[model samples]
Target chain A: MTENSDTLGATEKEIMYATHHAMVKSGYAELSISRISDELDKAKSTIYHYYDSKDALLLDFLRFSIDRFESTVNTTIGAHPKGDLDHIILTLLPCQLKKEKRQLHCVLVNIMPHALDQEAFREQFTEIDNRLKTIIEKTVRRGVRTNVFRDVDPAQAAEHILAVIKGAMCTRLTTNREAATARARTSLFSYIDSHLMA
Target chain B: MTENSDTLGATEKEIMYATHHAMVKSGYAELSISRISDELDKAKSTIYHYYDSKDALLLDFLRFSIDRFESTVNTTIGAHPKGDLDHIILTLLPCQLKKEKRQLHCVLVNIMPHALDQEAFREQFTEIDNRLKTIIEKTVRRGVRTNVFRDVDPAQAAEHILAVIKGAMCTRLTTNREAATARARTSLFSYIDSHLMA
Candidate 1:
């Protein structure tokens, strides 16, 4: 699959956009090609021509969403390692995404339960997670090189960071517990300060 | 609404058992009153006699599961503060659950997305989360009083600890990535050692 939306053909892009709107409106369980087609203002046959099933369409939507996040990272990431790390944290946490993209995060949250039983969906999620972890790992490595971070296992640090982000996202989105996420964010930064900072 | 399973009548307990099996077998999306009846080897009308809707039944099922967890914690929590904290941590984490209870956790994970749009479901989840957080907060407070732990904000510490547990649960369950959970567990214990240890 293409790494970013830059390489997607116009029709594929249209399909992805339709899928996003449909998922945000109807959620993943209720999402169907008919709903996506209605959003596309196109026929179901058109979606079938491109994707054999709704799962195929959703897999592409997952890629589309991740590519959008990659673009966000490209724009938001700074040369400063701490800034880069903080931006990444904010990006993953709920309520920080652009208003439009916030719905996309909800869609991802909706798809997570689906991944528990769907192997293809689970693999895509794993890939998305690994890519995010790698971004954090690289940032930690950069911080270590600059002497801003202590000598620590970058991979371990990345895992812990992403785990807390996932937790905060889940807690905030599912329970609407903003204070819990706030507390988690403080705890995470404190961990960085004590363990990762020099 | 009962705090534990002891208050549940025999029929209610039977319905809960049927629900556990049905949810584990079918997952939440496909769960139905009819399937639960099949598990009970009783008529669908019997289930409907007690609960008006599938959502109602599932809500009770959530309470049943939480009550089971409370029972486990009641038995497992030790007199020692550190042991109490560690037991709670292990209880919340994925792999450490009893074999039968693991499927129950999977059912909770499956039910999570349903909470996104359903108010009843969301309220139950929030209640469950609040209860767990309170347990952790109490544990931390006890630890601090006995000088086994530093004087940390018990609520903040509890939130952070639960967040990491949630992150580890999601990572392990969704991605099947044991190593990620392992790293998170280590990071979590390290956090406790540095921040909470007196």
Candidate 2:
């Protein structure tokens, strides 16, 4: 489990790209090698040559997405722990996502149910959840240590904040309601201002 | 639109029952009329007489689910506003769900992605989200009025609480992580105790 997209081969990169588009267009349940190859404008044999099945390809795509997400966080944020936390909250809100990223979010949301039945999918999703939780946990710990945030339980606070992020994202995605996310963002930042900031 | 399960006729009730079992077993994506009929142990024509297609059947099932959920909340809770709030939170937590109810939750999670592509599904899901939010909002308002809860923005508080409920459910369902929900439940109850209670 490497978090380096740079390590992927050229063909692997292409497959990931095609898989993204295919998932965005047809969703996870409808996604197939043929649909991915159609998106790639290449032979299905090309995808089959590298990956044995759709689930394998999807797992790779999930890893690729995680790598991209990590790189984005590392490069775009981290100026300050609080800023990083706020930026992550905004980024996770589905309303703030751009078209392509939103499609990616949609597909990830789509794949969540499959995780119920597929152990491989469940493991990868578990990793995804833990990785995100860990990131938030680290930031909270750093903030508390630096005295920028009030003395608080970093793990518990991180869980609460991540809950708001996940809840806002799910509300927006599942309901397609803009007001829900708006309210959640307001409530979360208010908590950070009142309870978290020193 | 009506939240009365009693309005359903005998065959409609039977169909809803069969649909519930079918969805619980096969899931929404794999669900078909044949599967539903198989669950009913009846001819395909019998189901077709009630539902024109799978989507129609699913739409009714969604309404049926909402009705059942509403009845459960109304009957099981409502002794007092604060107690109702706590009970709703406990009810929405997937970890607290029984086996059959957990299967129903899984199917609802499965339907969320399909709602993205299908407008009717999207509308029904929006209703589900709003209905839940509204229930919490009303409870919060009542609690505040009765002086059981601290003076707070009822709508905002409701949204935040609902976010925690949803976030906890999604975390449990997607990652199959017990620790996450346990932490979430602790964080949420702590928040309610410190922030909301009078």
Candidate 3:
């Protein structure tokens, strides 16, 4: 799917976009190609021609999201490469709490439980989670090595950080309570200030 | 549902048990009264005698779960009244990670997103969450007053604790990654020591 992005035309982009919104609304099992095509005013064959199946389309969608996340993380880290952990962490939280990301977060949250039943989805998610973990792990390790963070095990600390963020993100998406969302986000800063800061 | 436990007969208990398992397996929309009755080897009328519809059944199930959780929390806190945070927190984590609780946790995790679409479910969940938060809030306030914990906002700390536990629980329920579950569970203990310990 990523091999020929340049070759992906406007219609293909539109199909992917509509497919994403459809998945957000309906989830994987409930996803309807016809509904997406209806939304786009195109035939289902348009999406079928680009991606053979719903799973195939979603797989590419997940990859696209991961690629986007990786790039965003890199850019955020690049802007704060000198170990401003608060800014880096803040960058992660607010975007998710915003109204626009709620649907996407909801869809992904649904995928978590379904992963227990579906092998393909589980594999894709595991791969994505592992990649994300590695990114956080590298950042924590660099922080420790540079003495910006106190003595701490990088892997364990990374898991904690990931847990807070993922846990917070999932909670934010699941519970629409603005207070809980803000509390989760702020607690991350509280956690870093209390534990990791030098 | 909670009133007059003595008034609830064998059939009511049986229906509640069956409905709980059905919700765990199929979620809210897919739940069928006939299927639940079939599981109990009874007529659909038998369930309808107790519940007018599926929503009514599920709502009672939610209340039943909350009541059970509240009693369980009280019993646990009573046992650890002096701020034995490890025991109190440990009580929260292991049960969900166990094989028996996975399906129940899955049902709850799924409810989180369904609430995003259904306002009634959202209200029900928010009420349940608020009650649960209050329990933690009171416990933390007592802990602080007794000097068992450092100075921290009880509400904020409760939110953090809830996030870590809920986040950890959702992650544990969704993924069969023994490593991820183990890491998330391990991270919770690490969180309490770093944040709540005086």
TM-score of each: 0.91, 0.91, 0.83
Task: Please state the interface RMSD for every predicted structure, separated by commas.
Answer: 1.3, 1.3, 2.1
Candidate 3: tens digits of C-alpha lDDT, residues A1-198: 234234457887787678776765665446777878876788888788888887677666665666656666656554332344555566567744454465566667655655666666666666666666787777777777777777877777666776777766765555546678778778877777777777
Of candidate 3 chain B, the 10-residue stretch with the lowest lDDT total is B79-88
Q: TM-score of chain A for each candidate?
A: 0.88, 0.88, 0.77
lDDT of 1 by residue, B1-198 (tens): 435557778998999999888876776667888888999999999888989987787778888888777667556556877888877776676446565666776777777877777777777777777878888899999999999999888998888888888878887767756588778888777778878989
User: lDDT winner among the candidates?
Assistant: 2
The residue-by-residue lDDT of candidate 3 on B1-198, one tens digit each, is 224233558897788778777766676446789879866789999888888977777666666676666666656655343444555456667744554466666667656656666666666677666766787888878788877777779899888777766756655555545566567667767776667767
Clashes of each: 0, 0, 0
Root-mean-square deviation of every model: 2.5, 2.5, 4.0
DockQ of each: 0.67, 0.73, 0.50
Clashing pairs in 1: none
Error of 3 at B5 (Å): 9.8
lDDT of 2 by residue, A87-107 (tens): 778777744567777787787
Q: What's model 1's overall lDDT?
A: 0.79
